[model samples]
Target: MTNRLVTLFKFGIVGVANTTVDAVMFALLAVIGVPLLIAQVISYSCGVANSYWLNGRWTFRDAAREGNERAKLIRFLITNLVVLVLSAQILMSLHNMLGWSLVMSKTLTTLMGMVLNYMASRYWVFRLAIK
Candidate 1:
């Protein structure tokens, strides 16, 4: 139980780091006149890269090992892609239909997707180790 809590804490830290990367990149792209959709894709890609590195190196370090890294990366990408679509839909709905600011919409979407990302990564992406 204690170990699990510690792992969760680490995961949260890594998540925050990823979020920072995403927000910064998104803002930068937007400032430079990139389309909102393209900025989102670029930011999310940066976040995904950060997530894979931090989660594999720290959050799930105990399970990281040889022979499974490629599989793990693949699984992680698949899970992230799903979450990305969900997030994009939510953001678009809030921005287009509700008159919310893009930043606000994206922030809400990010928070909502965090749990889904964690669950899918833990249960599906990294399931091989536990089994």
Candidate 2:
């Protein structure tokens, strides 16, 4: 329990870094005339790639195992794919349907995605292997 909390804290820190990558890249592409959806796809992919290494090394160090980094990265990417789809829907709803600013919608979706990622990472992606 306590360990989970500590891990969550570390996860949050890593998430901020990842989110910054996503957001900054999104902003860059947006300024260059790329559509938001396409920008998001590219930005989020970059972030997820960064996330696997950071979370595996830091947030769930003990949960990582030998001989399975490739498998773990695949699982991590799958989890992020689900989360990204969900996030895109939410972003579309808030920013496009509801007329919120893109930044605001992205912020809201980022929070939601962060929670989902933590849950998935803890339970599925980074779970300690049983004997």
Candidate 3:
């Protein structure tokens, strides 16, 4: 239980780092006149890349087996792609249909997407092989 908690804490810390990457990239793109959706997509892609590296190396270090890093990266990209699409849709709906601020909409969608991403990555993308 303690070990699981530690893992979760590490994951959260890594997530915070990823969030900063995403937010800063998004803001920078927006300031340079990028559309909200486009800026979000670019920023989210950067965050996904960051998350894949940090989470695989640090958060789930024990779960990373002696295998091809490329394969793991592909799996990570596939998983995050699904989350990204869903999150984008949610953010777009809130920002476009409901007139919510882009920042607030992205924040809400990101929180929801984070839960789904963690579950999918832990159980499906990076699960340890059982003997």
Candidate 4:
């Protein structure tokens, strides 16, 4: 596979792991009486933390090291914060407004955010410096 494809494959793997973490946490929190919105934020935060650590060291390791470490972390946080807000909104709309199950709403929101998440991670947060 080409370099981009290889990187995408790795990102996909991390995304699965991240999704697992998010879903499990969300389910646990919800079952324990946490509000859906709060559960969504807390669970997604866990996934974001996992994503930063793994994706930095594994999926995007070959990305050009143009920026400082602090800057990279900040970018990653901002990108994820944007994604989280959108995901939360979508989840709420699907579950509350549209009368979907929580599981179905969460799954759809995650799928909807996946591509945009990957694109921002690759092109903005962990940008490769062109040779």
Candidate 4: lDDT of 108?
A: 96
CA-lDDT, candidates in order: 0.85, 0.87, 0.84, 0.87
**lDDT (tens digit, per residue) of candidate 3 on 1-131:** 78667877887898999989999999999999999999988998898889988888887886676457777778788888888789889999999999999999988998888888888777766677411
Sum up the clashes in candidate 2: 0
Better of 1 and 3 by TM-score: 1
Query: Model 2 reaches what TM-score against the true structure?
Result: 0.77
Q: Which stretches of candidate 4 lie over 4 Å from their true place?
A: 22-43
TM-scores of the candidates are 0.77, 0.77, 0.75, 0.75
Q: Show pairs that collide, candidate 4.
A: none
Who is ahead in TM-score, 2 or 3?
2
lDDT per residue for candidate 1 within 53-119, as digits (tens), equals 9988788775665337888899899898888789889999999999999999988997889888888
TM-score (C-alpha) between model 4 and the true structure? 0.75
Q: Lowest lDDT 10-mer window, candidate 1? A: 122-131
